[model samples]
Target chain A: MSGSIAVAGLGPGDAALMTPEVATALADATDVIGYIPYVARVAPRPGLTLHASDNRVELDRARHALQLAMAGRHVVVVSSGDPGVFAMAAAVFEAVEHGPPAWRDLDIRVLPGITAMLAAAARAGAPLGHDFCAINLSDNLKPQAVIDRRVRLAAEADFAIAFYNPRSRSRPDGFGRALEILRDVCADERPVLFARAVSTPEETLHVVRLPDARPEMADMRTMVIVGSSATRTIARSGAPFLYTPRSAA
Target chain B: MSGSIAVAGLGPGDAALMTPEVATALADATDVIGYIPYVARVAPRPGLTLHASDNRVELDRARHALQLAMAGRHVVVVSSGDPGVFAMAAAVFEAVEHGPPAWRDLDIRVLPGITAMLAAAARAGAPLGHDFCAINLSDNLKPQAVIDRRVRLAAEADFAIAFYNPRSRSRPDGFGRALEILRDVCADERPVLFARAVSTPEETLHVVRLPDARPEMADMRTMVIVGSSATRTIARSGAPFLYTPRSAA
Candidate 1:
């Protein structure tokens, strides 16, 4: 008897934000698999098996979770943000499709959660109110060439951009390079919003011009949003928010 | 004694997608105020006061909810998607700022929830994998000049675009005008993904080129995602998904 699998979103932070369906799915699961921090989000429940690993081992962890589900154990694959938005859902589906035959029959559902971009946008009074995009600056899984191309395209198009996984100790200059690409195509005065650890205790939101932005301000936990050509920063009560409208109206 | 206010996001659709926090908030609220359809979403909980109205009266409803909150009645202002994403959250804030002085001391925490764009992107297998923007095609709140400018900017920047309130019974050509602006600036062959009632039982998602898209297929409930220059559609298992990459790698 193969048990089903649910890939649940834990949301930005706080256990209360978890959907009731996600909570029930995690509670009933015999095994839970995710990156270490996300796995820690759920408190210890009865009859639960935990699989946690570093960032590099996500594919393997997903496969192992699927295997557990195939072995007649309920499993919940967890992700910090929406699983499908550069989170674990794609890997789960990829593994299920390319993995062994026995894994094919397992039930799968991808539950939605609060994404960092949206949380950050909300915190900053709608930085994403207009046209925008999100780019992960980490070059580990993807190449620098590709990141450069997307950044150039986003900049050239003047789409507001949110930078995820923007910086880490290993790749100090990746964000810098991406920023350069954006600056080249967009105007120097474009607004760049930085939201670090959005919704968590350490959450911080900064709205600044492109020239004033610094790479040291971001980290793995930070999400960066850059405004489009039309995004304007108005000083209200000494705090600025980025807003773009559907129309000038 | 002032009653607290709860800001809730009803996910794209499907009551099961409601987060535990949102569910608990809705369940515990004495009154829920929102557009009529959103008010109907809450399960018939005992002791729940429902304030439903037409779409045009959102600001008025929000003011009424604030009055309830000031009068020491627990009230929840509900938005169908994430309250912040072109929804009720901003209106709530606006009302609080401009409403009667009695509302000044009230505590407000803008809770996070799923946005339709995110849910639609998830259902479409990551059309938002890279960078993107969401533009509302409705011209009621804004002018057509602003809409055309933003659409052109998004296309020039090559940002994936999610169009909200794309079409309605009265303004059937709004989406068509948006498409015209997009086509003028971006390639006419850009991929456009359409998602309706995302995450709900009536959810539907399809991908077509911009040139082939028809305004007749869209309505108020529709969300149209137009891919960037780099976005590509791949056929998998007899279904199509728009794929955008963080990097070409």
Candidate 2:
């Protein structure tokens, strides 16, 4: 009897934002595996076991889930946002591609969830309402030159950009360099939104012009969205509504 | 007495894909407005008044939603995917920006859901696991030159590209031209995933190489995902798994 592996997304932080499909997957799982914070999001039951690992061990986590499933355990690997977007789904696939040939025969499913960028965009209005690009700003996986080239081209292409993993303790200076490139390429006051811990009680949103954006404004938990030239803002009583119009002239 | 409006995403044709936050908004709404097909997805209850409008009238539909809210009616303007991504959220904000001063005072919120591209990526493998750009291939909103330039730059940037509205009845030749541009820039056999009506009964997925891909493979309902240079495919018994690796060369 072979079991299955379901890679699920827990959504940003709000429990209400999770889909019924993910909730059902959690209820049916005998083993759950993920990062420490994400694994903590799932409730423990009588028949379930939780495996929480530290950061930077995505490949190891993927292998553990695969091993459990191959051993006939119903395993669910959880990610914070959409599993397909810079999350556990990719890591699991990499493992399967390099692991035993039998791993390909296992039933593996990637369930979509409300990603951090989408959740952040919703909280700050539709900053990504038009054509846009989502880039993982951390240079751990890719070269810095690649990140620089993409940001410059994204500015030249006039696409709204959503940046994931903007800053960390070890990689604090990369985001500043990215900002410098954006300022060099885009010579305007385009709105930039730094949405931290979106949908959570500790969520905070800050909007600034491109020239006013600083490196320290973002941390690891923040999702930074830089608007295109066509993006607009509407000021009322509270925070202004930010959006890119449907039509681009 | 004042009323508010909530712009909610229904997700990609699956009831289970909808977020509980959106379900709550629909349950609390006195009026619901959306495109004809999307509005039909909502249940016909005694207290809810459903306004089903035709396509291309997004601005008018948005204005109607604002007017209903201003008239002290709780309204939910439904979009098929995450409202912030190429959907009703931008149109609603456009209406609010151009409407009367009182409209700005109306409480408006955007509740995120699983977008079409994310859902399609999930149904297939995690083809969008790396940095990617989402472009609306429809020329109705932006100039064809703009679309072509963005596609060229996206290919040059080596970002996985997700094309929305690849082909429509009114515009058939744009996707072909866009494909030509990709063929010229990429010059290699990258994978392309054509996912149509994902998560629905009519859902279909086709994977093809860049040279073998045809313009007719996509329709208006299709979400086309072109892999980056780092994307890999694993062939097994059934459909091959497509995913872009997390680390780049």
Pick the lDDT winner: 2
lDDT of each residue in B84-182, candidate 1, tens digit only: 677776666566656675565565556678888877776665566555667766647566666677677667656678888888654567789988787
What shift in Å separates residue A112 of candidate 1 from its native position after superposition? Answer: 1.1
Clashes of 2: 0
Candidates in order, TM-scores: namely: 0.81, 0.99
Residue-wise lDDT of candidate 1 within A46-76, one digit each (tens)? 7898888788666688798887877788889
Let me know the DockQ for model 1. Answer: 0.34
> Model 2: how far is B181 from its true place, Å?
0.4
DockQ of each: 0.34, 0.84
lDDT per prediction? 0.74, 0.93
